[model samples]
Target: MRKEQRVKKNKEFQEIFKKGTSFANRQFVLYSLKQEEAQPFRIGISVSKKIGNAVCRNRIKRYIRQAFLELREDVQDNHDYLIIARKPAADMDFHEVKSSITHVLKRGKVLKKTSYGKNDRKK
Candidate 1:
């Protein structure tokens, strides 16, 4: 991910928290806000001390980042997203984390609909 495509400023994170809509599952919470100035989506990852120590937190963050990277093209651009990890998230492997992120994003209606089965596609 590029620096330009990350939410790095504290003020930016706060603004997203204050103004954005959020979705959550057992693993993570996703906060999102529209920003026309954002060419591609900007993302921020948060892991609280309650979840674990530094190593554990960093591991969860890495998993979340990898999941987002895989789904970046399917996600809507021009938005800022904040992903806050939950306690259960610390125990999950990469595939679980990816699916959890995908589930949340789908619930949030931020991802383009993908037809995985031939019968599911129209036309």
Candidate 2:
């Protein structure tokens, strides 16, 4: 995850929380807000003490960053996304976390669909 692709400032997070649309599942909650100008995607991950200790929280953040990196192309650019991990997320593995975030992004309509539908089977 690049620094430029991260939502690091406190004010930035607050603005997104105030203006963003949110979606959630058992594992995580996603808040997305479109930016005014064209820019790269900025992502933030939140895992509080209620979820775990420092090591556990950091692990979850890493998983989220990796998941976001994988899904970067599908994700809408010029937006800020905040991912808040739930208690169940602490027990989940990388794949689970990836699925969880993708689900939320789909529900939030932030993940762009391919023009060629899934039914177009490869020869």
Candidate 3:
């Protein structure tokens, strides 16, 4: 995650945990909250010690970062996003993590619906 997106404190995490909306799949839980300022979306990726040792946690964080790198375009506006890696996420390969993030984005309505909606079909 970028420097702006990283929620490096106990207080910010607490605020989001208390107020942000959350959704989860097998690999990750996504927490989101809106920001008043007009900046692009920001993100935080968390991998706890319960999930693994330092090396393992680093690997998982890397995968999460890669997923976010690919997904930034879709998610990079309007809200703040946090991705908490599950134990399963640490063990899985990159593909699984990517798919999980995509699912979370769709569930969170971060992915835009196509313009070709039912009304557009009439044209």
In candidate 3, which residue ranges exceed 4 Å CA deviation?
115-123
lDDT of 1 by residue, 1-123 (tens): 778878999999999999999999999999999997748898999999999999999999889888788778788999999999999998899878988888898888898766222222433
Instruction: Score every model by TM-score.
Output: 0.90, 0.92, 0.84
The TM-score, computed over Cα atoms with residue i paired to residue i, of candidate 2 is 0.92
Q: Write the per-residue lDDT of candidate 2 for residues 12-64, one digit (tens) a residue.
A: 99988999999999999999999989998999988999999998999999999
Model 3, global lDDT: 0.78
Candidate 2, superposed: residue stretches over 4 Å from native: 115-123
Model 1 alpha-carbon miss at residue 59, Å: 0.5
C-alpha lDDT (0 to 100) for residue 74 of candidate 2? 81
Top candidate, metric TM-score? 2
Candidates arranged by TM-score, highest first:
2, 1, 3
Tell me the number of clashing residue pairs for each predicted model.
Answer: 0, 0, 0
Candidate 2 vs candidate 3, TM-score winner: 2
Residues 1-123, model 3: lDDT tens digits? 568766677777778788899998888899998888898777777888999899999998888888777666666476777889887877788877777788887888776565113222454
